[model samples]
Target: MIQTDGAFGRPTRHAPPLLNARHAEDYWQQATRCIDLVRRKMASVDRPFTGAHPEELKRLFEGIDLDAPLGELRPALEELERVYLDDAVYFHHPRYVAHLNCPIVLPGILAEAILAPINSSLDTFDQSAGGTFIEQSLIDWTANRIGLGQDADGVFTSGGTQSNLMALMIARDHYGAALADHGDNKHEGLPADYRRLRILGSEVSHFSLQKSAAILGLGYQAVMPVACDDHFRMDPAALKARLEECLAMSLIPIAVVATAGTTDFGSIDPLEEIAALCRAHGIWLHVDAAYGGGLLCSRRYRHRLAGIEHADSVTVDYHKTFFQPVSCSAFLVRRRSDLRHVTHHADYLNPLCQAEAGTPDQVNKSLQTTKRFDALKLWLTLRIMGADALGEMFERVIDLAGEAHDELARHPAFEVLLDPPMSTLVFRYRPADLCETELDELNAYVRAALSRNGEAVIAATRVDDKRYLKFTLLNPDTRLEDLTAIVERIVHHGRAWCEAQAPTRAAAS
Candidate 1:
């Protein structure tokens, strides 16, 4: 409770005020204690997760009052440790190979500590003077690395989804204006023929493109899915045929979205070929390299994204492959002028006069007004670990995936899919006696069983209507032996499920 009758009418609260000199020690001590608890928890990474059920979690949290304080910091942190930290999924653990979540580097963690206390918003220059420059510098560095031209500019976004959204939004407005006799879509509504506008992408491209179309008022129907080859990469010839068909039908092509790294198979599309097609069609090319953009620094695998420089815009999520924490991603454009489509100046935040006077405000280029200082995390990471060191870590994980792929291929019970283009391996359990339907059920059962036991964590996806298991190797510490053991555990669960099903099948028959 706050007492309003204090000196100078300042409220006297149970919690210390931000600049209260008397309670400074108390604040420092409590923060240090929390940090210590985190360090201990991180060090003890024996289990990937506690496998807490939904009902159990609901029971544990149901009694807590959101508005009420728990009192002392020690008791509060202890309660958090018991109810949240203990049961939370540990991505740093070697067995946790389920998603694109990467084990964060030390410097990134340190940056979080620093940024949280300061609480600087990177939106306006007045709010974050040096912060704006730092973020812009990081974006410029990333743009240069991508080989985007001198006019390349970008803004840090919350994640890849937002970046993808911004990219499509820019593309839509750019082409829509041309179609509407150079009218502004922001001032005037989308052209009357917006229904015929279409964006092209591979069938395996991220679903964000479809969502972007819907958000842009183009409707989800406006997205045209191109065919992918056997390797799960976009087929250039098929894309060409589709473009020709669209032209014949008088459908306007807005943008061509190419996936540099798809989620399930980690496949890299034919970027150079796709760029050529987009160039010929005079359409905007946006590459969603959220998962594969880290390869820009990878000494050994940089050639995989050879034609990314030709992209009109690109989305890169550092959290996915650059060993950074979540919410660190950027939307980069080849020409800085393209971003003006999304810029709307407000009198209060970033006035048009201020921008014209050469003031650099981040909100002018971002969809978000109050943005986090996420670039600091990447800055600290680069300074401490170096780009080459990060690249080597990525290389290790990619190599581990190859080794795991080979092991799965040689194993008698497992059927390995295509060799990984990056660091994801898709495979499934297959017994000689069981049919395809039974095998699918067995593999799904195996995944559930492993998840329930909390021994290992992996992912599952469907390819060509068939269920398959996936191991997304983003943890650099995860070794070939650990992957092999996880595969063995999966096999064990699969065999047990198959045996249990045999008697039931016989009875049914």
Candidate 2:
């Protein structure tokens, strides 16, 4: 029980300050202990998430209270240490091969810890004078990478989803000029004379684009998915056909979204060919390079993203491929004027003088006003590690994925899909004497077993109406041996499941 001064058996003083000196000291000591524990954990951890122990977690949070005193929290804190700090899967661990989240370099995290507490808003120059310069510098660097000229401008977004949404907003406002001033016109219903607007992208284009279309009053049907070739790339010929059909229907092609690297497979569409189509059709070209933007670091791989220069806008997620922490993404445009489509003003929030002073006011370009200074994390990442090192890390993950694919293909128990275009590998466990249906069932079993055992966390997706396990290689520390071990576990579990079901399967057969 906490000791408190009382008058007439009632607490005389107000409740203890939330963070008094004693509590602060206690927290500091606990934090120090946590740091030491983390260092020790990091040394031994390989795959943190999948390798996590769940029973440990249940016990940790069993009866923790929200309003508990600091002294009372000691037990819960100890419990948290027992489960999360000790048993949780560490992405920093070499064996973690689950989600798209990368093991962020320490420098980036350190910068965030400092900068976030200060809470600098990048919305305007008055709010973030030096921060504006930092953000612009990073945008310029990214623009140059996309082959957008020196005149190009951009702003850091929350992530790829925000970037994609901004791209659609610009495209829609440009094509449907009247709609910009009259969003209410949609409720009034699209004008009888309004030209039919459409967005074209590969079938595998990020789902965010469809949502963007819906938000813009274009309806989900406004997005037309073009055909993809065997490589899962947007087939230029098919896209041309779709555009021609739209033209025949008197529908205006507002924007053509070409994926630099798709989410499932790292497939790069034929960008140069698609760029030509956009030029000829006079439609906006927005490259969703959210997944493959890191390829800019690889001289050899950079060529795959050709025609990015011809694009009007591009969305790149630095967090995805650049090893930055989450929410660091940028949306860039070839011409700065296009940003005017989204520009808004209010006298109270952004006075005319501040706007007219020629300040680097990011609010004029951003969708949000009170934006966090997300640029510092990227800035610190580039400064401490340099672009070359970061690029090498990007290359390393892709190389590891390629190597794992080949090794998995050679193993008789596993069937690898066609080679990865970039880094993601799609494959499944195979058992002897199994038909196509049985094989699919066994693969499903393997995936479930991996999840239940908490030995490794892997993702699964369907291609061509068939399911396969997927590993999106984002962690540089994940090695070939680690993948091999995962495969072995998958096979072990799959074989056991198959054997257990053997009698029933035979009867059905």
Candidate 3:
């Protein structure tokens, strides 16, 4: 016979009531202590990368015995809590501007903490009944945004990288269906008529396309990068010339990748021109709108991504511009049938007939068998905030970027590179008397020093081989003050570094 504690039964020895009483008391005490620690840690404002009391961690795990008793475990756990609680960079703090990651909404974070551990996997209906439906709903919602009609299909991928890979997979299979039947002679030996597959994109297209090329059995050499115009948009004439060259070389131009918004400068490529070129060439057109897709929400800025509707497929990373947390990304296709190219059969899992019937099996449409229902966060965000609210948020950020451009230009010590086409402003830290080389080095040093000191987080990139600092204003919480403050710090630090180098330059001279 098992004795219970009025809740559930644990395997017990023939121990006395006092022993169990001590165990329950000990658990409550440790839990209360942990809760208090959490509360205090969150309430503190320093946002320290390392906690104040690092040495106290040594005592945390030293005296604990796991097998002794539940009562005996409290002291050890208290130590464990002390060691690991408050040593992370607080992204929620307004200064975190390094990458495209967004500060998560409070409700979304709460939903993730609760639902993630409960309904863990979204691979099949049995494992994630409601979760599968929710993910599908989000996919359908995104498809509608692309004007894909009822026959459209999409899948939530890990991020922009995986989405680009999936797009390549669909394009490759659609162009090379013979490989599905015979596993491709190249897998065993090169075929006599093996023609190189070519992909064309602006030089500023995301590096993910190169990675996608490598993964799709096409070498990086196979991906041809066409030149972009002065504003970094792809030039259709350049792309047409490259396509003509590829044709003359007898290379199969498999896909044309257009950038709706580039990574470095947020420069939108000539999408309408590229789309028309792709149609003329009978090539698959994929618009990599990962950064610019959020412009879909803004009527004022939507014209920037014109001809996106003509894309055979498009990739969108909601985390970058939509302010959705990371991994809420997808690839949208013009036709649902294109996804059939990535389909496969497993005897134990999705059988032939079930997939053929299209019973809403996400695995059939994805490269990943076991996927996360990352779409829930987006769904919940939309349901609560509505599309207009998110769109307005995007517009506000773009508006702020414009303001930043004007202000940075007005500052005597700074040189704003170009008008922020989207939300990214690329600029150099130009001091009053610094030469070209000195100014460039000073700016670079400032960026490195700020990142090292953890005072602020900003991005650095190269355009035409010259390094420039970039501000990607993805966070709606980030204000004009935040941008100006960081720019001021960069100027101050850059000037200091340049002054310090003056004596060295004189000595060398």
Better of 2 and 3 by lDDT: 2
List model 1 lDDT by residue over 39-104, tens digit each. Answer: 999898687977778888778887789787654566678889988998899999999999899999
Higher-TM-score candidate among 1 and 3?
1
Lowest summed lDDT window (length 10), candidate 2: 4-13
Displacement of the residue 79 alpha carbon in candidate 3, Å = 7.3
- Model 1 / residue 120 / CA error / Å: 0.8
- Positional deviation of 253 in candidate 2, in angstroms? 1.7
Tell me the lDDT of candidate 1. Answer: 0.89
How many steric clashes between backbone atoms does each model show? 0, 5, 1
What are the per-residue Cα lDDT tens digits for candidate 2 across 1-509?
A: 55543211223245453434545554455556656666777776644554334575676677667576334434545666775666665666555566677888888888876676467899877788899999999999889878999779999999888899999888877765544555533245454434488899999889998889888778888899999998889999999999999979988788999998888888888889999999998899999999999987776677778888899999999888888887899999999988986677777667667778776789889998898888998898888888888788888988998899889888887778778988888887776787778877877887767766667778788877777888889888788888888888887888798889889988987
Q: List candidate 2 stretches off by more than 4 Å.
A: 1-41, 44-46, 50-64, 67-76, 79-89, 178-195
lDDT for model 3? 0.76
TM-score of 3: 0.85
Task: Put down candidate 3 lDDT per residue, 50-131, tens digits, no spaces.
Answer: 4233355556657667676543435545555555554455565556665566666654654564565465577666677788
- Where model 1 places Cα greater than 4 Å from the true spot, the runs are 1-11, 14-16, 19-23, 180-182
Better by lDDT, candidate 3 or 1: 1
